[model samples]
Target chain A: MIARLLMSLTAVLIVASVLWRDPAAPVAQPHPRFVKLDKHGNPLSPWQGPWSCVLDTTQQLVWEVKTDSENIHDGYWTYSWYLSGDPRTSDRARGEANLGDCYFETSRCDTQDLINRTRQAALCGLTQWRLPSAQELSSLVQAPARPGHAHIAQDFFPHMKHGDYWSADHSQPLSGHYRRFKQGALAVNFHTGKQYSLPYRNAAFVLLVADLPSEHHSSRTSGVTHQPTTGN
Target chain B: MRKATFVFLHMLTIVLVICSLFTGLRFSLLTQDWLKFLSALLPQGNLYFWHIGSASLLSALAAGYLLLSLWRPYRSSPSHYHLWVNRFGYLIILGLLSSGWLLWLGRFVAIAQPLHFYSLWLLLIYLLMHGWAYFIQHGKYVLSALLPKQPDKHSIAAVISVTAGGLLLYSAAQHSAETLTVASLAPEEFIEIDGLGDESHWQRAPVYTIETHGGINFDDGRSTIQVQALANSQESYFLVRWTDSSMSTNHLPLLKTQAGWKIQQNGFYEFDERTFYEDKLAVMLSHSCEVGADNTAQLGNRPLDGKPPNWHGKGFHASMDGKIRDLWHWKAVRTNDMYLADDNFFGPPAIAQQGQRRYTAGYQPDGKESGAYVMNWQWYKPGLVTPKRLPDQSNAHLSVLPWFGSTPYTAENDDFAPGSTLSSILYRSNRFEGDRADVRARGTWDNGVWTLELVRKHYTGSEHDVPLTNGTCMWFSAFDHAQVGHTRHMRPAILRYPL
Candidate 1:
């Protein structure tokens, strides 16, 4: 009797399953990317060294490559664009301690001064290493597949920081724009793909960009001057 | 008459067969084209509703049949192997249906997805066995009985009814398929500034050290950890050796059986798994964090000069805060067998209204129902006493859901085999839903020393978690046999480099 009942039940389920099956459905296909357009930035040519600097062809800029040890403090390093100033002077909050003073042969220098001092050594065989403008620095960012990390073209710039990096464009004495490796929180830089105007004194990762001859170069550099004065 | 009934059942079941076929279990031969064709011919009104409704009815009917088979005379019919197969088969169907309902509700995602998925395979196998048995026993006679002499009006009506019922069950089953904190501790141990001294290769060790809260006397019967910190470029290892008088593994449980309702008072007279709490260790981490404005998540005052406070905070955060803190809690019972610990943390709740309940974290195995919780039924029921039994006697986990008035485990129903005794150490099950925790730990005990290794990924990418760095500060706590009893220190220990 039990067998009879189950057999009948199974029979009914079979019929139900068939009725619901999708026969004419198209073959499954993967979802398309958001855009079909493809473009790879011009790779840096005339490049040199084990610490190879990249020439971003798309933006016509030279980048000083960063490694885990390139600018290390203990193991990882952090630095401010400037040491201290008020919110109006530099967009940084007061009471935050300075992580370090200056790394160059000089006694004291802001992130800009450090960059300027290092360029004299011609470490990358390129003496024009200047703090990159916020836009130029942002171009190197590829927002990592995972959060709390920076998306650098690691093959060229090894050991990109997951922390914020300093930008050369300073709107106030206290604040300079920085592009963080990871998104920030409230009362702090929050977005990953944009510039976070931080205090010049606040420590961050640094990546210098050297100008290259190109039509887009002028437009990109001049645009930084027009950006509204926003403090970090 | 039996033949007539069988014929009618066959006619009604024809619709079910169609529904089952539509499921495309066999190579999914029926495609969307077939579905489009059927939808045009079918009376469509929320197929999901009708399908689930019919399946529920079918499931209940099958359950009733099982209960009937268990009745006096039929219960003794051990010869009916097919009956037993069908009984268990229907039970699986019921489970599948229940999981389907839970999935629809968007509750217990961890448990329902797997249960709903596997139960389908189990049901299909049993049904095939059911069909094979009928063919084997009744043979040609069974086929003949299902075919009536002519299609009478009653048979035609039964067939139509079955089709409509099939649609309901189809919708019901599809409905089921659709879905799919930080604590601070202060541990104090004053080790040689160079973690390794006396030419012990501690050249690059950290310069600072930490002292425990109150400097609890090791001889005061409180546990003390002789700690050493070591870190190279790759990983950090903390060797914590603690002196424990006894090795305890008794976790509190509720046993219900035939004797009576008895609660084993933990450690009152003897070690009882139902009452004694398991020994535990917890670690929390934070990076560049100040307790957000909310008192719920504060770091107190750790001087930038690397100085800790005079007292250590105990238990959970005194207040709930919006900030994130990564916590790794080590429980002996859950992970010892699997070599995994309950990894948990404080984070934003999946739902908004849950409030602090969302503040809690736990583990339900991936695609499995097991979970771990420090607080259990012991919190509510108090003042019950249980007689001491052989500590080595084994205890079994019951499948009781508790609220359904199921028989609780008692000494009688929880029987001991005659002349045979098994160790009554501890046992657990995988039956939980929602809020899975993340953390892993391994611990070992010998003589009176407990050695534990707490490991977590260096980068968890969790906002609540602090990155493990040389400058990272941590607190510690140790608990012995006493339930909720933990020993902690006042100051946070800096993770100094091992010289």
Candidate 2:
């Protein structure tokens, strides 16, 4: 009788865990739209994420904004695009993701953990999430960008830093692409929104992007208004 | 009532109770005095209402369980110990609730603090006692309560799956922690304190990388703090660098807005924890020489026997008696621009002077200048110590946005006006002395990196400061944005002065 009770309880717990979606997951779905970019590099009209996924109305990709405020600002959590001995294949990322805690359970959550566990968790309700390609990542900065303000669209992405982010595309195992943000009280070392190559061992921030979503984009309003660029 | 339903509620209650206990422990740990590290992840002063709310529910349930026992009585012939332990556990739970409620309401912290703290353990003890009683009531079959008579692949698969999941989480933390060696060599040339870290002497210095341990909830663990050190015959120069997504020098200030005396956030005022403290760093040097007979260099505060009812000061950290530890705190706001890190030492308990309060430590420049600068904001201010502001003192505007004036803080911008104690210390104090701001630090938050150059005389000839030697071990903690009673560190890196 006791055995039956314990097994029954464990089964109920497992079922309950999967059925509930984490409320922190992004609410927006993904779709493709082709549009023009302002000279500052911002899309002509602001892109909106129903939850936290930014739909590049123009690029048609869904990008996960580092919604975790602590992660968004934490410099140490940054990672290289590739982990050593990683299968280094896109298909492996597409397989069924076994889930685990990325924050509390681990000693460190690197790019691999982000891909496997965070991806498995189906953040923003998509599982095929992976690193942005070189060009895809480069599109974030609009240089001759204002000093101190994010070169990227603040409307969609807030709490952004000028720190470089890792891009999946790599020339050699050692070298990978990174997208830069404007730095300084003034954008002094501003690179006019360009991509640079560096060693894969170098840590860069992770911002996941997914291909077109199964569900059509949401028309639901996010309630946040866009602030126009004040930068020169 | 169904047995399964009864078990489920009890089981869920147990899980929440355990969670509450841990959160309660964390809440208590962060309240102590000896902390030197800052948490960039958990915003300080975030009240854990969930912890209290959960504990309350647990207490209520435990009460209900005990009352139910009274209604039915333990009829089974299980040991009398089980019957008694369960009752005692419920009583302890009630005790926890009462004390926790008192702690949450902020009353009699001295009494409520310890009672609520220890009650969690007492309650757990009851659980252990009750566990044995449970086995007595159920017999040996309870050992494999969830197992089938025959082991099956499903069970093996389940075990393997759980083990693999643990490994996945464990693998993230598998990197070997390297012992970074800090080589101390005399610089070939006099080091300049300019923001630029490009001097030839600096270029030749040994670079050691240290990793931050806690606050992984926000970080990827890939960020490395670069530490480079070089000492000359006259002075020692240490340069530390790290990457931050953004820079913040915004120290929350006491503001007098249209509504009246207001500050941006009340964390600093309410609890010493700060959400808007300037991005800062600290270096703690504990002398290995003459380490107490106990062989410990770091000293703790003297234990209080009687609650000095009139104790008007914030207490000292872990110091038990006598010797103090050396601390060089670099604040991006209050002390940095002044070319001075807060030269603070922690050791002796606060000595009540006829007119002032003093914590006796070695290096302080005598004239009542040691310890933290802020009154550390406890309700114990002796009198009306309002700061006076003078808006007309100067037109220095704060450069950053979110605020309009040339400066983020101004003496005149506060409720007390010229009396607003002292506003932003960007402009040097008019009556400063040599010892007032001793250690010189120059750094700028440019782009994503803060390049800091710190220079101090090799020896200040103070009994308090231990002269730098080959085997000095100093702990470093970086605060992205925080202040006061803040202590946390992963591992202390090794720094060796050249023979």
Candidate 3:
């Protein structure tokens, strides 16, 4: 009986040890600035690399850009959230596709389907979101060697995949010219047909940006006060 | 104890044989030339026989050892023989895998050779076997551990084995650095010549030496020549000596011509005459070659009419003039009546000329002319003339409008009429005035195809008629073979408008 009791105690101790081994230790929490997500959502692995949310002032839109070496092209690409529900429904902010704007056309956005998607996002109070320009996307790349810029948020957008991301910038149609930012190397994509894209309703990732004030010329004698604002 | 000793020795022998086989093969591959020389000393077919014999012996030993290890009935006992074999085998496999992969991937991928693929397969198999053995022994707990864990006795052994295996593998891969012989040529090195009969050993003495440093270091020296050649032999001989400084003069040579001070050189000539402190010296030479009756170098019926022919043996005379301070500053002027060989004909062969009252400037192929004459000396520097000046500092007027093709005009007077058209204007300032003077002009082409004219206004309050000097003006024209005549003669007069 003593042996049985000791065995039982040992078994219980083993189970307790396994279960108590820090649940929160390896699983890091997302930064507070990031948008809240459902419980089932899992953040990117921490081992990946740096990630940022870039916000375009002209379009008032935000995008989640990730940078890592594991990507096929050794660059960064945008990732959009994939939510569940009617893609056009006001409450359906999920299931958005992560499409790259390698070859942009006004006709694609003006189609009935995209129009419906935009209307739904607007009705859902997502009026401030739109595609980012090529320049806006390139600004998010943080130079690892030089760290005067913003620090990479550690927890939420880790394991950022390195690949080509879509920018609203377009060249002549059929001529494959697109912008791609890979670890801060902004290059134009010559192959339009291979561009990737994501839907808007998805909860991928995004970067936010605000323009700083411009310097005033000393020659101007007028004592007019200047206010800084986000430039397009 | 005897059985155990035999087992250990057997395993050791197997490992040594395998290692030696790979090592020998790799050594033969790497030292191909050495091996070839050695083989020559042996009987013709004996080299192949010897290779087969050694390989067979090594394989038999390894097979025998393996068989002995497996023959043991008691599997539970930790045989020292088995342990040693496993340890050594693990190292050999790891080393071979890594070194082979690196070499094959780096060198053989571009060639797309069959041997590269075969070697790659062999390496992959070794890696897989090693991985399988590792997982089977460690179980899940240890398997989950990250690579390159802390070095203990097992890991230390692994490290050592891997290092040894790497060296052996590298040797077997047949990779070796190339050997090259290097020698330097200095300024003092003399080149000797032999067997030329009478002028047999004419010495070449380098005069001035120009050494290019930094990017690509090379020394090139020039020397004055004294020739001595055999009458029969086509080859000529000359003696050369090195001098310290350049011998070029920075002044145009005054030629005594029948046309009274007219600049004339037989074929082509170039000269630089400038008073600037650091003015470059100029040199010029000219030559002329005959072309076929077709007005072209008929080597292949190539265009010879004012165009450089694209063939061999057609001689071209080139005269270079410039300051001899540096080898890079030397400029050459080439002229050849042999058709396309000297086809760049927009103006006279002379680059720049100076006269007492009037100077005839040479024109570039791009229709821009530059020359200076005694125009009432105001400030010495010539002022520029353009159609319009932009506030943003953008030089939009610099672009040559096609309508003003080689027309003569002046800008001093508001002369828009045909005879009184301003071809060009000279800028001048009175001695009493502190301000400088400028000139400008404007006009249009007659045909719908060409229009837009301009002129300059001088501060001297003097008006010069357009096209008065030699019926030529500084204008812009395109280089089209078909439109050469029409383009050259269409120079319009410059009209001056009020500023």
Instruction: Tell me, by TM-score, which candidate is best.
Output: 2
List ranges where model 2 is wrong by over 4 Å.
A1-232, B1-28, B31-188, B214-224, B289-316, B352-387, B392-394, B399-436, B485-487
- Candidate 3, residue A43: Cα displacement in angstroms equals 6.2
Measured by TM-score, how close is model 2 to the native structure? 0.39
Residue A111's lDDT in candidate 3 = 18
In model 2, state the lDDT of residue B141: 59
**What would the per-residue lDDT of candidate 1 be over residues B1-499, giving only the tens digit for each residue?**
1334336554444444334333322211111123233431243111233334445445443443344335521322324787689578757767776765554443553566557656767776776777656676776685675566666665455445545555554444432211001111223322232112333322333322222211122234245555444444434445445666666665444444344333345433211122355566655444322211112222211111122111111112322334454555565654544444554444332111110111112111222123422222211233332322222222234211222222223456545443332222222233222222333345777877777754444455545455666556555555565433344432344454433
lDDT string, candidate 3, B1-499, tens digits: 1333344433444444344443333223221223322221122111222222333333343344355456642243444744655565545534443333332232332232223334434544543454344444554443343233334553344334444544454344322211111112233432222111122122221211111110100011111111121111111112111121322111121222232122211211111111211111111101111111001101111112332221111111211121110000111111100000111221222221100011112212211011111111111111222211111123112221112232222233222332211111121111111011111111111221111111111122211111112111121111111101101101111111111
Query: In order, what lDDT does every prediction score?
Result: 0.41, 0.47, 0.25
DockQ of each: 0.01, 0.01, 0.01
* TM-score of each prediction: 0.30, 0.39, 0.16
Preferred candidate (lDDT higher): 1 or 2? 2
Q: Candidate 3, residues A1-232: lDDT per residue as tens digits?
A: 4554565578668766664542111112222233211111122222221223322223333343332322211122233322234457654433334342211222222112232343344422233334445565554443321111122322333333223444443331232232232111122221121234433321222332222112211211122122111000
How accurately is candidate 2 docked according to DockQ?
0.01
Question: Which model, 1 or 2, shows the larger TM-score?
Answer: 2
lDDT of 3 at A64: 36
For residues B1-499, write the lDDT of model 2, one tens digit per residue: 2233234445646665776775554444444322212111111221243354465456555555455456653344535776688668767777887876554333444465567767977976876577544654565655544223443554344334434543442232221122334445554466678656887766767777654322211132123467788876766778888665557665654444444334444344322334555777777665532211111221222223221111111222423446656667787776665566765554443422111112222223322222223311111222222222233335323311211122322334543443232232223231224343456787777877777888777677654454555555566656666554333332344456666
